[model samples]
Target: MPENPVLDPKRIPRHVAIIMDGNGRWAKQRNLPRIMGHKVGTESVKDVVKTARELNLEVLTLYAFSTENWKRPAIEVKGLMTLLKTYLKAEVQNMVENDISLRCIGEIEKLQTDVQKIVTRVIRETAPKREMKPSLTLNLALSYGSRSEIVRAARIMAEKCVSGQFDPEDYSEQLFASHLYTGGLPDPDLLIRTGGEARLSNFLLWQLSYAELYITETMWPDFKGESFIDAIRDYQSRERRFGQTSEQLQAE
Candidate 1:
């Protein structure tokens, strides 16, 4: 069992987002195919979800597949889909038992029909479990772009402005945020990228504007509970000012 931290549980982040990277490198390091690394990485997902829910995280979003990921070879993509179906079927029961519900972000329609069916079943089955939301982004990105999301939101706002529904004075930061896909979800406090990568790679362009980042050299397949906790502790040590000066923050 992992040791519990000494701090008040209230200090834990309400939402945590992760960019699961380095599957190919994890497999290549051992002269194995990248697909194997992804398979093992799936197990790590189960481990992290179990630990996180126990620790009371309200939301966890995983960058499982990105719009850019579709550029990869066809065989590898099919393997990932198969892995998703298998993992979801097995874990959904456990998640429901533990009070964790599921959600999907990004373009989920590109997934194979069977895979979609399973995902739907699990989501409905786990709907009653509300302690945590476990979300996956299939970024099928079929054509997802952050710039595009912002432009789309602006267009909607423009339309509203032209109509009688929106007042110019009501257009605030909160109003713009409500127009985002992640509008209702709490923004990620800590964004993690494994396999030593430090860049955002076009992930969560809007939501991560104020997030603290943690990069790990450990490949995604090897990312376990201890590694995850290290990232959380690193996050806890930082100060999130949201644009206030250090002196002003201290005064508050």
Candidate 2:
């Protein structure tokens, strides 16, 4: 895909997170099964991942499934797991070839046993080597929820303090953040949500505190590379002062 000529290469976001939405709606409008929407959405995933790598993004986090998704119909849930397994099996080799490391952030153990095995294998296979640093890290949020993540981190901190391994008085935002699933990764600089959604939907609440958000009406399946570049172009046009006035930012 041709790069967007308007993008300032230096201003590209290092980390980009996406909430892939409207899959079911897309399929419904086409008179197809919801799973078909998910299936087609994988192509968009591929396109976005390729675009991010070409742009030299450090991390690309995708909200694949949420903890609440377990409440969905059993058949749909099962199909999603099967699709996830299939995607991992088919994409692991490509990921390795492209120097993209796969990482999952969520209650991975909650997935089906077979799906878990494949996920583990993909992560292991795509692990970055000392000599071959990964061009991008593809982080999938499977069976994930931000509130639960924050609670889990809090519990870990409490346990550490009880064991005398941590001092409560020394606690800081950094200390608390280190216990979260995304401990070592940089926070997303840009978050894009498809399907006209205006809500966060319990995704990366803490990490997205200061991130620029881009919402699109296009469904996930149709969000190709050009759509992604459009988001980047819009992002570049904004002023992210991070709580400072224009004068203050310009002075820096």
Tens-digit lDDT string for candidate 1 (95-159)? 76777777766656777788879978877887753544443311112223466567768888889
**TM-scores for every predicted model:** 0.86, 0.97
Model 2 pairs in collision: none
**Which residue pairs in model 1 clash with each other?**
none
Best by TM-score: 2
lDDT of 2: 0.94
For each candidate, the alpha-carbon lDDT, in order, equals 0.78, 0.94
TM-score of 1: 0.86
lDDT of 1 at 84: 85
Instruction: Give stretches of model 2 more than 4 Å off.
Output: 2-4, 131-133
Q: What is the number of residue pairs that collide in model 1?
A: 0
- Model 2, 108-189: lDDT tens per residue? 9998899889999999999999756689999999999999999999999999999999798989999999999999889999
